[model samples]
Target: MPLDTEFSVTVMGLGYIGLPTAAVIARTGAMVTGVDVTPAVVETINSGRVHIEEVDLDGLVSGVVARGNLKASLTVAAADVFVIAVPTPFTDAHQPDITFVLDAARAVARVLKTGDTVILESTSPVGTTEKVRDLIAELRPDLTMPGRNRPGEQADIAIAYCPERVLPGRILVELIDNDRVIGGITPRCARKALAFYRRFVRGACVTTTARAAEMTKLTENAFRDVNIAFANELSLVADTLGVDVWEVIRLANRHPRVNILSPGPGVGGHCIAVDPWFLVAADPANTPLIRTAREVNDGKTDHVIARATAMVEAQPPGQPVACLGLAFKANIDDFRESPALKVAQALAERFGPRIHIVEPYATTLPPAIAATGAVLTDIDTALETCAAMVVLVDHDIFRSVPLDERRGKTVLDTRGLWPDQA
Candidate 1:
């Protein structure tokens, strides 16, 4: 059943996940306030403009803001429900850093009141949700916390962990349609969060303990990382043996039980590359396979950098070398932890003005690449001029380039988009 009550919602950290979540929840007839530390993000959304790129997001946010169902703020506002969707990036040592999550928790603690539901939607380490619960309990001792409350007693607040499961290109549809695993500090807390999600989610909402839900999100990403590692490792073997990794995988998958993932420059983005390490950090000794998978995936990026550099090196000293695509995945503008970005940055540092980057989605090169004198060019400009090219991302713009246009060019296709040219 849908939630019967009309409740106010406060969505903290309006980035990739939070802003869309805020907009979608606003569609449910709930008053949604999207909060962010950035003044520009607040201003942009308040003016019915989105700073990020996601399909159908700008229109949705615009409509919700115009209809008075949604607004963005620089400060937290009191609401019936609070959603924390901040980035939980790793530290310099690759350890999971929950400082942003903790800061968001403190902010929520200040505004929390009796009966308000606090749900964390960030992908985090196991027990990080418990840490949030503990921090909030300490800050607001006047209110009773679940899991710390006496037996047979009701707590003053509900805290839950529900991770988002959505692809970047299709976040809105998946956000509404995907099943959710709502985990709480207690059974009552889980039920409380489940009721809130039922308001918007078309898919089933299953209840569980907070720790289990946290692990489930990590496990999901880690499992994919492991599969990708196998493909990446196979690609390396094929490269060494002068064989087409794509054709090899295609043939191997003819067997009933074989299903191999495609290889890329390396794993990137906020989830698959980052979440597995959290599990490894929790118990390093027993997580050799997970740890090794991470190593192999990271190594693939270095491999791409080295091989792409060699390709450019083979060309004349002053010849332009085009590096295609920068986004982590195809058809999206997001470049968080992108291997393509890493490759471009390294090549730019080495070749300077000789490197030309062609990312159809990016209007301007990232500052780091731009500072290195790597010019951002269109596909036509890259193909007409550059002597050597490396396909880092399989964006449609790069895929549609015909063979005749690429005839004389030296090409290294990491994404296997042009298996013939590769």
Candidate 2:
């Protein structure tokens, strides 16, 4: 039976995942109340604008706000559906620190009512949904579980874990287009969740037990973490052996069966680098592959820093160096845990006033980044006068940069963005 009622949904957290999810639910004609701990985020979403960058998110949010289907608040209220999309970062020793999830869950529990369905949409460790169920049960002992069509005797709250797997840049398309994994504490719980998502989801709905679904999400990221580590490790070997890793991968991938991952400065952003440790923290002895992969990817930051430092040391006396790109990857302005940004910081620390940074996407240098004495300059000015230009990010703007005039200047291409002469 499809639950066709107008769902009054409250989405907790307003970052990358939550805001989009809230907007999409509102697009389905359901009334959505988005809650964020940060007051600024609440204000931003309420204004029909977004603080984060995503394709069409601004328009989607604006439309929802204009339609009066979506609103933002600082705390949760009673609702039919509650989605917890908070952060689950790892601790210093690489253990899963789900404090945010726990706090959000407790807050949601405060407003839970009869027949309410609580979905844990944050990427979490296995058994997290069940743990949430237990927490709710402990908090509200009078409510009964939805079983045997009984709906229990008291106020009932159904709990499920539906992991979101969508690309940050293409969240809107993937939200409806990508198949979803829905797992609940009970079969009734699972069915109810599937029915709720079917309203907007164009892709398949994979039903499973809650723990399996949680592990499924963690496994997806672990898979990426491991493959990226293989590529990063290969980069170290290729550098030592004086081989072009990109060329080797290009040839190797020609077999069709062999697919080598691209090596970069380091893994960045929230997903790939952070999710694997959740598994490692849960069962330390059993996840050697996942743990090592995290170490490899995390260590790559230092390797990139060392390479740039060597360039700084080897530069001609008093010749200014230009750093191209600060973001982790090309075409995006996100600098969270960016290896290129770290490299620039390290270079400025070692070279002092000699380093000039060029990040075309960044309108202004962040305070933490600006203190390093890396002046943000335009692309032309950087390429024309700088003695050494180290290409850290493969931004397309740097592709058209005239290296002919830079024949005598040092060009250390860490990104391998330029073509080689025959």
Candidate 3:
């Protein structure tokens, strides 16, 4: 199919994934309208400024908005393609919540017309695309949807699921270069979405059933979570045995068949930390390993907090401690489910006004951390003033600190970033 440069796209939710996706699509000469519930986000994008951080996204969004190819809005608009890129956060009990997906579907239903293609790019549980189809069918009975029509009959609109499989810091590059799994309620739906993606994607768009696509995303994250859990569990064992976990991994990895991922304070971020729970929640009895992996990763955070607390307590009274990095991962501003943030907050609450934070990405500490009287200071000031240092996230700047600068400080290196002590 020939690419449609004149296509109009409305992408719901202008957060991390959605905004970058909208900007990328607009670069392909498509008229893209990014929709968000927050008025501030919409206004920010319309002014050619982005609220979220991503590589090259600001320049791309600026060029697209300046060229009049992309705009942001507070409500849905009629378009040939509607992409639902909202969040699918879990409930308090860790059950996969599809309320945001369904709500976005309802909003799209208002402006959905014949021949429009609706794609759910949000990471969702199995049958979520079908739920979206059902909700749209309920709202607009006048039009036919995929799965509701006969085998030989075509629906008035197409619906498909294509989850974003990009890393945080590399979203713009991966969005265009990574292979995509395009699944639909029907084969035609898959083909339609594949064609849309081919307009911009340099990757192979493989097609499959909607459920498989959903499960594929979950499986990808769960696999990483499991491997990470192994490394984290090994870290605990190494600690108990009085050995360096990083040194052990380094020597073991010399064998071609053995490769171990670096352990952190814990698994964080919206995907790996949260997606695996959906699978376990779907079938609790058959997923003991998955459940255990989640437990081990979560437990690692508590262990880090306890260790940091012990180090802080060992210091004399009035000796301030510095917590480095708050983002879940390094070099990004996203702090969702970040273990570093949790550890920092815990330390601040336990030792009021004695906790200083060194997060280069954030200008000010979040309310929760600020309320604990923890001051956000520069790395230089933190290293000079604080008596103890806890390296939570291995950000590049923190990793490059000279060994001499770390002298005389009680360092709790959760990420194994610093050199081995003499």
Clashes of each: 0, 0, 0
**What is the C-alpha lDDT profile of model 1 across 6-112, one tens digit per residue?**
67999999999999999999988789999899999999999999999999999999998998889999889999999999999998788999999999999989999
The parts of candidate 2 lying over 4 Å away from their true place are 1-5, 145-155, 399-408
Question: Highest lDDT: which candidate?
Answer: 1
After the best TM-score superposition of candidate 1, give how far the Cα of residue 289 lies from its true spot, in angstroms.
0.2
The deviation in Å at residue 36 for candidate 1 is 0.4
lDDT by residue for model 3 (1-422), tens: 34346799999999999999999899888999999999999999999999987888899999999999999999999999999999989988989999999999999999998999999999898889999999999999999888899877889999999999999889999999999999999999999999899988998899998999999999999999999999999999999999999999999999999999999999999999999999998999999999999999999999999999999999999889999999999899999999999999999999978999999989989998899888999889998899799999988999888888888778999898896643
lDDT of each: 0.94, 0.83, 0.93
TM-score of each: 0.98, 0.92, 0.98
Candidate 3 TM-score versus the reference: 0.98
Q: 163 in model 2: Cα distance from truth in Å?
A: 1.5
* Cα-lDDT of candidate 3: 0.93
Residue range with the least summed lDDT across 10 consecutive positions in model 3:
1-10
Give the CA lDDT, 0 to 100, for residue 163 in model 3: 96
- The order of the candidates by lDDT, greatest first, is 1, 3, 2
